[model samples]
Target: MAAIWIAQETVDAAQGGDRQALESVLAGAQDQVHALARRILVDVEDAREATQEILILVLTKLSTFRGESAFSTWVYQIAVRYLVNAKKLRARDPGLTFEMFAADLENGLVADPPKAPDQDLLLNELRTSCTMAMLLCLTLDLRLAYVLGDIFELDHSEAATILEVTPAAFRKRLSRARSAVHAFTAQNCGLVNQSAPCSCPRRLPAAMASGRITLNDYPNSGEGADSFQAVKRRIGSVVDALKSYELFSAVPDHRCPDDIRHQLTEILSPNI
Candidate 1:
């Protein structure tokens, strides 16, 4: 599972000022890097900026990346370092906690999606945004640990190296983060527990009323990302019954966002 790292020769060539090689390396990793940043940062805009920063850093520090670890792990260290310093993490959602909503779910409330065709589309955006937003609720270090250990399925050793901690320490921290997510999601998220009160259809109006999403911006008949099928593909289909890493896997990569892809292309195009 851990074998999917950049080749040593590729790393060496890039570090040796092989422009095409550097571009190749950056291109290969940019989407995953962007996805990680999106989860680590508070919002999409911040994630986009952080991703661009990571792109530049990857190129600038290519020579410094010793091949002592997985190239992806090395890249994460740089991404997290930049996010820690550059990202002004948004304030935690005052009303956001799986525990708080858990009780409501336990009370046996069933809020189904409205009969409208766009209801499915809205729910997709809402749940995906909600999941990603939950990651931001954590402190920087814990957040990074959760993303690596649970979402990305990295081994304890690899994650520890990325965060520069002992394996034991990484395991302990990851346990805490994982437990928190599990407890909340298991109780409050419909996808995790069938008895949960919150369903995408149920939460759609509230999410839209607050301007978290727009119908015009997302339509069932739209094209590209706008088409209902397209939207579902980008934000994986909801199972309403996720287990373990299944929930995180359902969340799409951040670079899947077109704007971020455009930004990455603009930044890496000239240099790479």
Candidate 2:
């Protein structure tokens, strides 16, 4: 949900073929674009590729910006369009229903397992992965609505503009998405319902056993990421329907790879 505002003058300079200005524009847009791509697309690699493609689209279409909206909104419009239509990107597994996920949660909970040296990091990874997979259970449109309206906390009008829908329509879609997620999590997630069968610690063992989580590559791991205690405290402060969403929002934004800017620089150098 972090955003860097691109000044209109900077946008104009970029449009006028200023390479540094262009890089600045794209760099400002990168984190947000990647964040949207990461949530919309399931795979990490797929999100990266899609983020690059969306930025290229933004670049190619730069001249068309007539300044009718904020540059960030314009960027989001392009990103939402590309992501919604990028069918070739990996689709969620056909069998990954709430029922299946519930069963998975129930199957491998270590009530009192020995702790690892990096328990917090591993638990963060598991929580992020599990919640992301939960989003995939919703259909693409619903998922977009939930992520934009709920997790990112974008205004309904703004989110509607990005999705090219009316505010009321967006709200309806978001309501559906929220209901589905809320229902599932209320019954299953320990953060939402303390008596629930699954907690991050309980599921860590299963996640590792299934190779869903590995120490060798911790995509969601980061320094000072929200700890389980912090997440629980936040959850306790929110209403029942919103606790699951609070948990989702608590996951750290996946950092965009540094090399993306370097790659963009290389791609734009010839034109410069």
Best by lDDT: 2
Residue 257 C-alpha lDDT in model 2: 82
Superposed by TM-score, candidate 2 places the C-alpha of residue 56 at a distance from the truth, in angstroms, of 0.7
Clashing pairs in 1: 113-201, 222-227
Count of backbone collisions in candidate 2: 0
Q: Compose the digit string of candidate 2's lDDT tens values, residues 1-272.
A: 77659988999999899888888988899988888888877688888999999988888889899999878889999998888777677453343678888888899799987787588778877877888888878878899999899878888898999899999999999999999999999999988888898988888888888999887567864633678677778898989887987878877787678898779867964564
For each candidate, the alpha-carbon lDDT, in order, equals 0.65, 0.83
In terms of lDDT, the poorest run of 10 residues in model 2 is: 87-96
| Shift of residue 161 alpha carbon in model 1, Å | 0.3
For model 1, where is the 10-residue window of minimal lDDT?
A: 219-228
Error in Å for residue 269 of model 2: 5.0
Runs of candidate 1 with Cα error greater than 4 angstroms are 1-4, 87-113, 216-244, 256-272
Candidate 1 to truth, TM: 0.76
Q: Evaluated with TM-score, which candidate comes out highest?
A: 2
Residue pairs with backbone atoms closer than 3 Å in model 2 (clashes): none
- For each candidate in turn, the TM-score is 0.76, 0.93
